[model samples]
Target: MTRSLLDPSAVPAELRPYLAELVQRVGILCGPHLLSVFAVGSIALGDYRHGRSDIDVNVVVEPSLPGEVVRELAESLADGALRCPAAGLELVVYDSAFVGRPSDQAGYLLDLNTGPLLPERVSFDPAAAPAFWYVLDRSIAYQSERVLYGRPVRHVLAAPSQRHLLAALMASVREHTTGIGHLPDNQVLNGCRSVAFCRTGRWAAKREAAQIISESEPDFRPLLETAVRSFERPRTAALELPATEVRTFLAWVRERVEEAAESRL
Candidate 1:
């Protein structure tokens, strides 16, 4: 029998039921091969917003688990079937081998996206995913994941090296600068979080990082403030930040990240 490590009380009250169902379904689908299920992102960081945040879950399974089981698991937990109560469910499944020796690049067996705010996606190919995001997310998970079942996070999740993290941060900055139709709030907050991680080598929640940055960089406070406010609003109610200001903020962040990366060499 797998040792259960879930603490229902640690989860937000409203999300508890959904999480319970999710864990139960996943256990049923993956059977004895399921190693662990845990929460990351906003929920793990204590910054979850009932109507605005997605539940980001990471699951680990034995290497021998069949691909068909993985596909069935994804289909069962998809938006229509599981009916995500939050913005959506962003779940990634990894075999124990990958978890034991995680790559700096993408190594997920499945990347499942579901929810009203997110475009539904079920990706099985690592090459199809952006590697930087996975690296950064794993870094964050190492620092603050909440295990819902199976073994402790530290036993299964490796902390990404500062070099890999900085690389990932730089890649994210490049994406923001060149990407089209980006979410303005995400742009600003991501910059704030990246700068925080670069300087402190610690992961802070999006708004927490923004608040810390706002004090030291008063010039960007208004932009950060606007982004935080917009981020807290329901998706339908959020307002867009000015494009020029967002570009400027991102440029500043790019400089900081580049400086941080250079200083280490």
Candidate 2:
């Protein structure tokens, strides 16, 4: 399993130490809550485009939401890193937690889009891969790393469905491409490949996506673009798909996602 803490050594001379530190600090604050926070958007998905992705984190808070926790979150938001949005602080907050059954082969993302006001303990997955959807239910693992503060962050699995993850991603891609009516071929193919692997049990998708990403040095600009497309193609509501093919699709999509995620570091 990939540890939530990434190796900052290979990061670009300019961004290596900086982003390495940022992800690490994110871990610290998240660790106390028994939550795992990971760079998702352009950074983690390896599809960043310029000015497209700000630091985005996919967080799953543990235990449950307590009113007192909300107050602590307010202070945490005082820091500039936290961004305010309909989701209260879109950037990061302990109040909002992603619920997923790490053991399930099929899952879908659920986030408190309304705000950090997590009145309930619900499940959410905040990841994007336009062409396809995937479920890393078994692959999901928890790892710890250092953050800005003298603290560490622990990552836990926030499993989501392979189909749902892909559909929302395609919607995002089409939105950004000005192809609102249709999704980009690359997004569909790549995502299809991803979904194929995740839904079914194909091993080829991982290698293929990695090959494309490996050919070039990891860069966040492209990943950011993907993130923008994802944001644009936001789903009006969750769409359902048969869970049968999940293993195969996820296999392919994971390859591409990892390729782009490499750039995030």
Candidate 3:
């Protein structure tokens, strides 16, 4: 078991204290059963915006916990859900069995945002969901730059293979863009980042990917710039992009991802 806490200064100004207290409370709640806890997504990436982005966290715990205990924990977590300064919070609890064993399927005990105990429950299939997505997250954890608590990320997560990383990228893009016509800034930026990862094995934030696309694929600069702007400054007023253009761009990104997958094979 490993435990190294991060300085509160790493998180956004408005969210640091809240996250610190939340992590502390959760740690205390789990106590002896707690294995590790850390963050991911925009917040971990340091690009999270107050009103636009979400805080993503993963808590690993002892596998012996009863389902009822998990439910109780979920309910407790909900009491502070709205306290998140970002758009919302997304937190999942996984068993400690995955510490070193890497697999394409990860079994999670609970997802706070879409669990049975939450009011905003959504459909989720843990079995069919590809675990390859954890590859990027594992990579982030190994870096130790974003870990919030528990064992050092490298000790807790297995290093993901290139094939797994690319597979996860494709899967995420398909899930987010399929049948979706209008693209938001995050979607657009994520699509570009997927393309960048597929071409070069290097993973990057959306902003970095936008810069890469601007330098390499100048034709897409206008769209990428617009996406960056939208992501940086989210408007409270209902804002929608041209559906036709979004659809076309999404199709192009999908095609690129497919081509990248094929090239790998």
Candidate 4:
């Protein structure tokens, strides 16, 4: 069986030491041959937002690690969860032996190491953006960008359902999120959640602006911010209008898309 130890590069920088220890123990306990580790969630994607409850990690092991070893490690790490108050900890361990079983049946990535684990498959989209979105209010204390064990994780840069997805994400926010769908949005609200979503969408817009400006034209941060706010303005308006104006909603979406198309030009 493949006992390739966890690749440290695949892990994130913030959880380096703990993962490193995990690697050491894994190697010590499981002999070595065909096992590997991978980072699979927000922390790896580089867009982890603030106020995340806990960091999620996927530890890929080979079929070689004994079931007992996997069980033992899981119990130990579960105890580690108590150390951090803000974020809960979970590890879904996987390798070749455990892939065929039900997907839901497998516990956290770390736990899979116990017996017949399978390598979790990951796929990435080329055009998707991983702009930083606020999880709670800019308090991502545990998820760091630095790569600790394996390759970086990612989110799709482009969306096939950009509008629909945006629509769904903002659905519950109509009443809850003040500035989001409000056209000609309140600049104050546009800048930050203020008392609303706290540091959510605006933070994403801010990060998106920074990245775009830095890459396309470092001086364009402000311009980019304005552009994002422009999108938010129209979107916010369309999202809130009366249901009788279904046609108007579609028209607005067409306008939003057209506007997006033009801005790229």
Candidate 5:
């Protein structure tokens, strides 16, 4: 099997030590069963904010990895244990077999969340996780091609299909519009990113996507700018945007995604 490790020189200096320790701990825990370790989200997208972003990671392991090892790995790297330097560490462990397969549903061996912005959760069941978010995340990770360790990302992870991505984008829009979860800044930026992804079959950072929209649709520039500013600043408390306007923006995103999907047909 192909193997590679991230070049510390390639990442921000502040993250160097944390990532080094993470690789070391994971290597010790998973041993030969470890297939790969990669970063996704803001880190991969080159928009990592020192205090705002989560250190999103995807760890792939051989199908034979022991359940005990999985639990131990989670417990070891959890925020307090590994000492997450960012807002948190959102890590998902995927069986190598699952990475090789294509499916509409999301599946993972472990979903560990640790950070100050959110509560801690160490989840093992896919049924308990948000499948749409996983679908979108997998698509983004595959596209980002940021591999911190092991074989190349393309060699290990199959890209989620456009249909699945669009479906996930639609679901995300619906979820945000309902205002059941997610912060206002997240809701706004996510909507902008979804719209941009639908228009161009490429993933862009949240801030980048907002810029794309502002240039193309000047009418929404003010709102998009506000969201981008909010995203850059450190969070102190829950923030809110105009609900009606946020919903309206998401509706436009849903419409655009539908249009893009239809064009492919």
Candidate 6:
């Protein structure tokens, strides 16, 4: 099976060295608690865009870690020494017991959303961590995790059922679409990708997912095209898609996602 760390050759050429540096630094920081580390999200999905993608990693440690140690690890990740390879490094360190089974409380020791110069205050308490959305992260990890150390991903992670995954995606879509005004292009495309996953078992990158949706629903082609281009060239300034159309499309997608989720239920 696919049980090894991601091949550097598979990553963007510029990102290889930095990816290697991450593995080494994480291994050092976690020490005995570190059971395994794996790459997830777009990096593992083979749809990583150089300028836009954040390297998402899951660190599996012992059942529990001392609060102090967790703090240190968080600081290390935010430190300039371990600069992120792309937009930023998005990471979550999960207690092994938490991953082995579900819990009422957060399962992570540390979680952060940080990039080169914009480091958010890292949190050690799982409950306080902003990125503790387990269902979504676990689903993504189950689908595309690549081992950086320890046992293979299949051995470490329990695959989430399609029903569970769809439900989580629908919940996210409902939350994001509920607000008024134009949803960001990334969020818009993410809703499309989640719908795509519900229809097809495969996990598609944002651009690929938008393409599939546009083909399946021609009316949204122009919007999806705009979103895809924005994702590809984050630096380029572009005209925004009309807010009315964006809201309409999101509402339509929200209904379809809810329908799909209900069927599974």
Question: Cα lDDT of all candidates, in order?
Answer: 0.87, 0.36, 0.67, 0.36, 0.83, 0.71
- Residue pairs with colliding backbones in model 5 are none
Alpha carbon lDDT at 9, candidate 5: 64
lDDT of model number 2:
0.36
Candidate 4 local accuracy as lDDT?
A: 0.36
Pairwise TM-score winner, candidates 4 and 5: 5
lDDT of 1 at 12: 95
Total clashes for model 2: 72
For model 3, the stretches where C-alpha displacement exceeds 4 angstroms are: 1-5, 79-82, 114-119, 122-125, 128-136, 143-145, 179-183, 235-239
Question: Could you give candidate 2's per-residue lDDT for residues 1-265 as a string of tens digits?
Answer: 1123444542223334445444454445445553544443334434333222233444445556444544444344433444322222223333323344432222323332223332222323334322222233122212212232322233344333444444434433333334243323233334443433433433233224434433442442244234224434333322222232322333434554554434332
Model 1, 100-175: lDDT tens per residue?
A: 7656778999999999888999999989977997888787778886889887878888877777778888999998
lDDT of 4 at 152: 33
Task: Rank by TM-score, highest first.
Answer: 1, 5, 6, 3, 2, 4
Of the candidates shown, which would achieve the greatest lDDT relative to the real structure? Answer: 1
lDDT per residue, candidate 5, 175-238, as tens digits? 8877675778888898888888877788899999999999998878888888888888876643
In model 3, residue pairs whose N, Cα or C atoms come closer than 3 Å (at least 3 residues apart or on different chains), thus clashing, are: 2-151
- Can you tell me which runs of candidate 2 are displaced by over 4 Å? 1-6, 10-31, 46-52, 65-98, 102-155, 177-265
Backbone atom clashes (below 3 Å) for every candidate: 0, 72, 1, 45, 0, 0
By TM-score, the better pick of 5 and 6 is 5
TM-score against truth, every candidate: 0.95, 0.37, 0.84, 0.37, 0.94, 0.87
Which of the two, 1 or 4, has more TM-score?
Answer: 1
Candidate 6 local lDDT, 101-156, one digit each (tens):
64334457678768763456576676673232566777667777667667676666
